[model samples]
Target: MFFRLNMKLFMFFLAWAFALLASSLASAATVEQIFKVQNRTIKRLCNERVIVTVNGLFPGPTINVHEGDTVIVHVFNEAPYNITIHWHGVFQLFSGWADGPEYVTQCPISSGNNYTYKFKVQNQEGTLWWHAHASVLRATVHGAFIIHPRSGQFPFPKPYKQIPIILGDWYNAGVEDMEKALAAGGRPELSSSFTINGLPGDIFSCSQKGQNSETFKMKVKQGKTYMLRMVNAVLELHLFVTLANHNFTVVAVDATYTDPYVTDVIVIAPGQTLDALFTANQPIGSYYMVASPYKSGGKMFDNITSRGIVVYDHQYAQYSSSHLVMPSLPSLNPMMPFLPPFNDTPTAHKFYSNITSLVGAPHWVPVPLEVDEHMFITVGLNLQRCDPATVTNDTCKGPMNHTLSPSMNNESFVLPKGRGYSMLEAFFENMSGVYTTDFPSKPPVMFDFTNPDIRFDLNLIFAPKSTKVKKLKFNSTVEIVFQNTAFIHTDNHAMHLHGFNFHVLAQGFGNFDPTSDEAKFNLVNPQIRNTIGVPVGGWAVIRFQANNPGVWFVHCHVEHHTHRGFNMAFEVENGPTLSTSLTPPPADLPKC
Candidate 1:
């Protein structure tokens, strides 16, 4: 009977490929929204006080969606303080209790409660954002999520307007008087403008240019093709944009998709996100975009830059209300000028190792041949000795009195608090004294980590806070590297890893040998990023596939090096079924 009809046609095509993967996971679709944070009062560099906003907008709204869809949201806080949003590069696959990260996933919907959040945008698409993960109000919340790709599928081409930008970083001494001037010991000022989507634009004029303007603009259309997304929420600065004569083509980042990369200056850091595309075909009118501020390892910033206009499409030209259109730009170092020069660092390591992934497009992925864990961390800053209940004052003005901790492999993480819950509800109620799964994988003492004479190695510049982490083992893969140190300072950091999105695979500078940097790995088509920038003293690597389970949060998106600790956390462990685990919590999570 012809070998039993080809084994009954291979068991009817393996049950019709699992019934079309359970009918496209039962046609996704969930999308909800609510947010509402509160307290708004716009008035950028000309101050009007009272910040923290969400529905009253201030770079807030925008969730859009498609890629498999299932957003939700809700929020509500009403701002007095305590918050938590973070969807930054969302990979909350099994929805790590909607991965928001206050005390790392849940808790802090306080100051007038309300939570919600939900997840799933499965195979991601383009730009991603959403901020505040608690306190210092992420310098005025954030926004933009935008996925799109399900039935209008696109791996490129198809754009006549999308824009978004976001950027941010303004400190007219707001976030509660810069947290009461860093709790009285001093120093919390700098950044007074570098906005782009919340305007600081008309060159912060109070004169030399009659007030008004609020900037922002955009408008495009001279030959179609537009896109832009961007994001970087600049808190501790790390930008380097430019749109003047335009170029981009990039395609995506942070929200994945790549391999188009046509650059002409873009860099970005602080919790990244890019997109790009361009094509206004120059000549029709208005330009000026800028953004500047690329500091390498710190020494005071806010050397202001942030502009934005773009314009064009007024039907073709001639329209100036008050004379504008100033752009020019183009010197990659033609004797230095047009942007990127706050220690260029090889033009931010040639635009983050020239991106890659986008191979055959459409849900690409591939790059996890095998590797169950291989860390090596390191990162920057160190120096403890200043415990007046830690940095609140009382006889400790820092340096010599020490203070700024920040670490990674040499420890310093700490973020526990009382033990009522959070830390993913103390790993879902199994609560073992709040936290500690070890977290080291390397460096208890390694030296010359890019030693510029290792800041007079006081036995390697101090370290040790606690709440450690790094457990991970559920679908595994990992890899890390990171490195970057200079004994007492060094900079560039950015790191950021939450639910997930890795695979940078290489970034270099000084030490990271692995026997000649493992022949410069790029496991074919690298660059995936969920925030990277680690290269001031240099070293990057990355890799991923832990498969999202829970207790996420990994830090250094800067905000004073994540409040002087750089941070850490991973936990993972689950995936042996119940649909790759991590679900429980969310019966309205928030509770500490």
Candidate 2:
């Protein structure tokens, strides 16, 4: 009996030791940050204005972590309005409760409230971002989220230095006031200036020589390569960036590695990120880096240029005297790297199409050979009738006796209204009447999608509004043809999807022809991205597997278009077992 008891104790101890070893091997790294959202006075372009900021940072703080790390951010809202932070490209995996979209995954954290976002970064490693998911707060509430590889070396050699280049828009008036004006049906107000890292830069006339004068400058050592992690956080503009006398080797985009391609100019849409490397090999001097709007569809945009300086430490000292005498910087005098025309759709398409996924890289998933679901979605701006009861004034009236609206598949998406419940919560609770899963897989009415000569009929352009979602089975592969209709405008729509990155198989202008386009799909090495730009008056084919269970938002990243209802959601059913299922919501999820 004594020998038997000793054996049992020894076996238990051995099992416990193995368990500890296993836990240690499987443990993930962790990164925790506390963000305080509050209003702070900042001077930009010679004006002192109060702006909403995170932790008093104009561009917020950058969160850095490894690929297999768990990130927890506790956001304390002290601002006057509601707020939520979205980890733009991070797959929340089973933790859908922390995927922050205003009403999709969770409710906004109201003023004076706090919420904690906790999620594990699965296989993604690159430059993603975080921004306010509510109201116009993202204008100032934005930051970089960088993830490094877990263990292996990067596909490319390590850079000597790395920097985050955030391009944004600036408004002289408060963003809330601009929102109100837009709601009043006033002409869409253009931003007063474009900014680079929260500065108007030395190129703008408003830049002064005082405490208010601001310019983003990067000092570089000679003959060393630097990695620029670029994010276009502009509210409505598609930007083109150029570094005078320098070229970039594009290595990654949207947190996915791509085959390196060299280019002189980089075109980026809102909600997009690009990682490029450039060597400081030019004559050591201050070179201007310019960011300007790339406007399409003949629409007005902020044409002012935002500039940053790339100064070589050794050369700047030698050239300092020459620059002091010349008030105007030499870099902008001729605009060394000429920007493509504002309407250069071909250049934009070329850059986007040239990117191919890195072969055999970590986290690279091949395009699914079998497709379980096929969807055809039409995205464009339209006009719909407004209920008089909800219309307060003439501004509510739109052109041709209708109200301006945007739609996907002829359905203007409306957010479900209630408090303390998100779309996921309602789904889990089996609550009816919040949203419907009857969203059409194709446009309700078929017409010449890209006909430029078609007459504009108000009746044909009107779309019905509803809170609807597309339902998908667990682990089912989905193929969507995003067709951009030429309605009120013909512009490139930057479509962004939350929770999962899809494979962009092919894209082109005009309507999509299955016979011709299906043959064009690059199934072997298609580019994987969380956001893609549907070419102006064109179409794009994308595919993904709905392995993550939860409600995911698919929308045009243009702030105005999303505000006007060009959005939809995917409701993916939970898998049969707990491993593939969504975890329960955290106890601290904010109430509406």
The prediction achieving the highest lDDT against the true structure is 2
lDDT of 1 by residue, 98-170 (tens): 7777777777888788988877777778888888877678777888888877656567778877878888877
For this target, which candidate reaches the highest TM-score against the unseen true structure?
2
Model 2 earns a TM-score of 0.91
User: Candidate 2 overall Cα lDDT vs. reference?
Assistant: 0.86
Which segments of model 1 are wrong by more than 4 Å?
1-155, 158-187, 197-199, 202-216, 229-233, 236-250, 254-271, 276-312, 316-365, 372-410, 413-439, 442-501, 504-527, 530-555, 562-592
User: Candidate 1: minimum summed lDDT over ten consecutive residues — where?
Assistant: 328-337
Tens digit of per-residue lDDT, candidate 2, span 1-592: 9999999999999988886665444337678999999999987766789999999998999898877788899999999998999999989998888888888889999999999999988888899999998887888999999887765358999998889988988888897786875676434667878888888787666784556567788888767899999999998878889998899999999999999989998989899999999998876567889887777784566778888788777543333644642222224332345777888888889998889999788889999999999999999988777667767675575555456678999999887757457898887777777789999999988889888754266556888888899999999999999999888778899999998999999999889999898999999988899999999989999999999999999999988788778899999999999998888888998777
Instruction: Give candidate 2 regions above 4 Å deviation.
Output: 1-27, 208-212, 315-335, 387-397
**TM-score of each model, in listed order:** 0.32, 0.91
